[model samples]
Target: MSDGAPDSLIPYDEIVQEALRAVVGRVLGEVEAAGGMPPGSHHFYITFKTGAAGVDIPAELRARFPDEMTIVLQNKFWDLSVADDHFSVGLSFNQIPAKLVIPFSAITAFVDPAVEFGLQFQAVSEVEEAEPHAEPENDSEQGAGNGVGSEDGDDGSNVVTVDFGKKK
Candidate 1:
């Protein structure tokens, strides 16, 4: 047997990212199959790029989060649907509901604190170029939902932040 490292001609990052995005799709699909958020699980925190292709965010939200934004999918959300290329969900802000269409390529993080499970991905690109490492910000201390507990009591309302950094 060879003891040397194996060579790779394919871009592993792209392949991994694609696979991760598929996990997001599969999760959403499960939610859809259930006809709603599972019992005791009523929300999600989906963060994505504001400028990525196929991302449809409100002008106000876009301005507020010019580069990235995290959306809460809880009691006030509706019309949750997922497609091969994108997913759409309706959310309320100030009691005004808005529909957002986010492409999987645009999604950066997906979290469901109730189960302590999460996924992170690199932004998708339309151009045929090498996918860059646009790592998601790890703001667990600032309550960005990285599975870190807080002073607040445990009500299954925790948020999970995605960390794209390699474990050292």
Candidate 2:
């Protein structure tokens, strides 16, 4: 036998990623069903590729975050709507209210800092890497700063990380 493992014919990574993305959809759906309000201190930090297909954000936001952007869904947000493959919500940027429509496929991370739960996924798009930009000003208090992509002091036991380790 060869030292390397043989590649499997199944697209396990894609399947698993799709399934995991559904968790985000379900959570958002619950909030939507609750009259667009999150229960208690629950909030979410959603990170997505700005250039990904089916992503719709204000032109200024797109310009500000040409590569990727992270939006917080907490107090001061409204119109929380969730669809099968996408979700849209209204959030304020610099006190300017804007509606963002982001597809689940474009989402790379979802973090619920209130419960220290998070999910990280591989990019579904061939996004060109660019300099990281500051998080958008959503007019919400920057709490413990448990950002979806941050590796803070938290043990992150609740964070679900998926890495297929595809061979080149």
Candidate 3:
């Protein structure tokens, strides 16, 4: 399986990641277009880097989730707004209503268990209008603020994480 080809000259990995992340945006945009999550069934479990630049979350949720958090968009969320690079939503945590603004570049994982579909990306900060985003402060290579998951499906869900073992 080794053709002996060297490393890629172009940042193909980053390019592919961005395109995949766009899927998340497109899905959310559809929801926004419908005025909210469609009449029934579909939902999302989005996990993102809280410390990533352009991420605006409540201090309490920030303190609680710190590096990352998984939010379920099923019933309780409101005022869902989708933008070109980010999305804003209102959700309740422990009876506290809070608003969060997260840039697509900060999202590390997106899952829709109902359809058994999910995606995990190599977490990177995306460029924003006027201000360039910065890499989130973290101590892990797996990114997403959360620790690494198992190679097996033990981590739960049918999420498929693609890790191209190419030389950097």
| Top lDDT hit | 2
For residue 79, give model 1's deviation from the true position in Å.
0.4
lDDT of each: 0.65, 0.81, 0.74
Q: What is the C-alpha RMSD of each candidate to the true structure, in Å?
A: 6.5, 5.3, 5.4
Off by over 4 Å in 2: 126-147, 152-154
lDDT of candidate 1 at residue 164, scale 0 to 100: 36
* Per-residue lDDT of model 2, residues 1-168, tens digit only: 866778879988989999999999999999999988889999988988887778899999876666678888888899998999999999999989999999998888898888888899888744433223434462233333225555732674588878886564
Candidate 3 wrongly placed segments (more than 4 Å): 1-4, 125-158, 165-168
Q: What would the per-residue lDDT of candidate 1 be over residues 76-152, giving only the tens digit for each residue?
A: 67788989978998888777778899888887777667676566665556511322222234222223322222322
TM-score of 1: 0.69
lDDT of 1 at 76: 69
lDDT of candidate 2 vs native?
0.81
User: What ordering of candidates by lDDT runs from best to worst?
Assistant: 2, 3, 1
Of 1 and 3, which scores higher on lDDT?
3
Q: What TM-score number comes out for model 3?
A: 0.77
- Where does candidate 2 clash, by residue pair? none
The Cα error of candidate 2 at residue 37, in Å, is 1.2
| Candidate 3 worst ten-residue window by lDDT | 126-135
